[model samples]
Target: MKLSKNFTNPLAANNPVIVQILGICSALAVTVKLEPALVMGLSVTFVTAFSNLIMSLLRNGLPSRIRIIVQLVVIATLVIVVDQFLRAYMYDVSKQLSVYVGLIITNCIVMGRVEAFALGNKPWDSFVDGVANGIGYALILVIVAFFRELFGSGTLFGFDVLARFGYTNNALMLFPPMALIIIGCIIWVHRSINKDLQEK
Candidate 1:
């Protein structure tokens, strides 16, 4: 049950993106297109999962005085690996992602999970929490990117999906602000559905 909660809560009730409002920058920056958004999401998921597992494994031996520094080092190393991997195989998407890939080291979602959950939890549990939160964040990115790319460019993953229907692409949907609006709508709807998230 404990492991289940760790894996499930972040998907909704404790979502890192919509609920906790963490990692919104990348959500907006990379969601202009579906491909980049998917790549970014998977990258974050990999980093989060491994970072949590590593930190959890080292928690007992890590000195409190240097915990934050150590966490940064671990997170940065993971981010670098992801960045390099993207540059190697997904060069175009990596170029699209730009510095946002490097910025994952400072992402509140990654650091927050490490500090909040990984520090004291067992390795497996922390890994699950990280994967859940990363997926939660990724899910929002995909949804936002789907709408943005589909309507803004009339394409999904660079394929013309709506052109045959005489659908004109909306230029405004390509902007970062549009992603914000979409995320806001998502949050509002999410809160409405999950009444527990609504303010009493």
Candidate 2:
């Protein structure tokens, strides 16, 4: 797979969140705030990209029977490195992210992309696939976070963005359920605008 082909596909045609519906957990859990959501997104992107790169390099040596084990090892190593870097340089954000950071290990999107695309591709192509999926996932989270922070809290990134107009916040937006609704609405709107995306 070519890097450009791999990268663009994830962002649109094969979006992990919208198309594959993977990584919805983080999209709901850590996206109440913009900054945290952004951090989580970047972290996941970094892990997925590098892990896929490593897996692509090792694809030939790994046995089919133990492929899951190989994938787990690669994912775990990448997550740990990301965790340590966050703890060292951005303790506060790291603390906010908490268990969710560790939960990256189980995020189906990361593993799915690695197994589905990375395993057979070259390192560069795999890396692009990771980035594309990460971005695809991030798009939903960021959009949801933008609205959740906006309406649920009357702020953007925790700063008051519409206070002067006396727009009080709705507490419901901060919860995980609201994120689902926001995401659903996003999908509806996206599909409505792009009729080609409509269900058959």
Q: Which candidate leads in lDDT?
A: 1
lDDT of each: 0.94, 0.86
Best by TM-score: 1
TM-score of each: 0.98, 0.94
Q: For residues 146-200, what per-residue lDDT tens digits would candidate 2 score against the true structure?
A: 9988888788877788876799878898889999998888877767766887779
Off by over 4 Å in 2: none
RMSD for each of the candidates: 0.7, 1.5
Error of 2 at 76 (Å): 0.8
Worst 10 residues of 2 by lDDT: 1-10
Please provide, for model 1 over 132-162, each residue's C-alpha lDDT reduced to its tens digit, 9 standing for 90 to 100: 9899989999999999999999999999899
Where model 1 places Cα greater than 4 Å from the true spot, the runs are none
For candidate 1, give the lDDT of residue 121: 95
Number of colliding residue pairs in each model: 0, 0
